[model samples]
Structures are given as C-alpha cells and as structure tokens.
Target: MSSIVKTNKFTQALSDCIRSNPKFKAGQSYADLSMWTRLCVGLSDTEIFSMLPIALRNVWADEEIHPLLQERGAIGTGRFNVQSLAATLVCFRRTETQNSEVRVLQSQLAHLSHEFNSLSFSVFDILKRLDRLEAENVTLKQALNIGGLSDDPAGLPKTETQQISIRSDQDAVTKYVL
Candidate 1:
C-alpha cells in the first residue's frame, strides 16, 4: 500500500531477475550494481531499495549460486508481484546500454572509413604524378640524345603523316612558288 512496500517489492523482484539472467557474470559485480541502480531510478525510492538487491543477486558465479542468492533476495515481503517489475526494469536498462554502445561504435567506424578514403585518394594522386614524370623523362631522353655523334645520325622517330597534316594554304603557296 505504501511507497516503501512497493519499492521493496520491486527491488527484491529485480534482484531475482538478475540472478536468473544468463548474460551477466559474477566478475562484472560493479556493472551489476550500477545496472540495478539505474533500473530502480524509474520506481519510487523505497521500492527501488527493496528491489535493487534482488536484481543484484541475479549476477552470480554460476547456476549453483544463482538459486541460493535468488532465494535470499526474494524471501522477504511482497515477493511475488514485484519480481516481474524488477525483471522489466533490468531488460530496459540492458537495452538502453546496448543501444548507446552501438551508436558510439558506428561513429568510430565512420571516422575510420573517412580516413581510409582520404589516404586512398592521396596515394592515387601520388601515382598519377609519378606517371606524368615517367612520360616527361622519356620525352627529355629523346631530345637530349646523350653521347650520340652529331653526324652518326640516329634520326628521331618519324611522326605519322596524320599527326602533322600540312595546311592546304601552305601547300598551295609552295606549288605557286615552284
């Protein structure tokens, strides 16, 4: 009837739910307590205290310890009804925590992807510059002809006729002069 009674019932029920949960481990005791506290925040102060420990008991070393702790946490007054409320609270807290972690991971992944893209583009730019340099080097080698005798003519490679088409006006002028 009173807020304290309801809160106690909630807390006991919560502890029982925790003990039953398969996801949690005894090693994560601090997490267990914190989760219990968060769950209880939604209920009345008195109900929260009653239910908080019950939820905490749910985190055990194994199945063997779980039943013992579950019994201890749920033995008090208003045990039956409040257990359900405590279980609901735990589920809510777990989901909320999981969702928050997912969002954080997604943001980190996005940042890494952006960095990878930038690095890839930079590498492509460098490769493009190198290719241009190679073409230019070939052109320079043809022009210089280092160590070639002036008269020992290895003539430059001939351009195709299509590559250097004569102007029609120039051809006409040459013909008239001839």
Candidate 2:
C-alpha cells in the first residue's frame, strides 16, 4: 500500500489546487475547517462534495458561515449555514433516491443467495436417492445369484446355470420359512 501524505499543509495544498483550477470554489470554505476534515483528503477524493463542508464542522454555528462569505465572493463560496443547506437540500428533493436504490439491491442479493442454498440442498438430496437406488439394485442382483455375472461369454453362459442352481436353494429356504 502507498504511504499517506502528511506533509501537504492545508494552506499550501489549497493554494496549489486553486492555482491549477481557477474555477474551483470548494477550497475557500475548507480553510477554517477542522483538521480531521483536512486529513480526510488523503482518503477521499481531492474534489469536495457539495454537502461535505457543512457536515464536517463540530458545531453548526451561524458565525462560522459569515466569516467565509466576507473572505470570498458568494459565487465561488458555498460556506453555508444550516438553514441555507437545508433549504438547498429541499430544492434537490430526491433524498430517498440513493438509499432506496441501495436497499433494493441488497434485498435482491439476499434473495439470490437463499435460492442458491436451496438448490444446493436439492442436488444433495438427489445424490442420496441415487445412492439408495444403487444399493437396492446391488441387493437384487445378489439375491438372483447374478452378482458375479459378466457380459455374454464366447462359450455357453454361466448365468443361466447359476439362476437354475439358485431356484432349488430359494425353494428350500421358502419351505423352511413356511
């Protein structure tokens, strides 16, 4: 993993950023921001989200918003008070769109996982039934005295003689049971 950059001071980085992009108005609001917010630059994108400036401050004081407006013109600055931010969000009016989409995707994933597990169980059950059928087939072949029988031989087959021999044995066993 790459090392985190601790050396880029806020003032210097801000100046460097604004110099490169003349239209970037996001930096002016961040000048008096908490250090925690500044440190987040390394983790998050270089460009500020419009909502982030209001969220990061520990306090939502109106006095804080007033100073930033005096330092920079209103156009490039979004140093907003709580009331203004709430009003702006009200204008946007699609607050539930992102959250609802995420919830829908998560529920879909859960449904698919449940279906896959049930299918796996069905496959296992089929394999067990096949094994039971194979066992029954083996037992029937042994009872008929054909368990050792091979394919039709070049000479006379032994299976006919074996079945004939077992007939007498089965008759004697049946008499004993009676």
Cα lDDT of all candidates, in order? 0.58, 0.48
Question: TM-score for each prediction?
Answer: 0.42, 0.34
Q: lDDT of model 1 at residue 140?
A: 74
Q: Write the per-residue lDDT of candidate 1 for residues 1-178, one digit (tens) a residue.
A: 7765755565455555555765433222556545555545656544544544554443343465566555545333244434544565556566767989999999999999999999999999999999999999877776666644232233544356633554565788899999
Residue 154 displacement in candidate 1 (angstroms): 17
* Candidate 2 per-residue C-alpha lDDT over 119-151 given as tens digits, one digit per residue, 9 for 90 to 100: 999999999999999999878766555655543
List residue ranges in candidate 1 displaced over 4 A: 1-81, 146-178
lDDT of 1: 0.58
Predicted structure with the largest TM-score when compared to the true one: 1
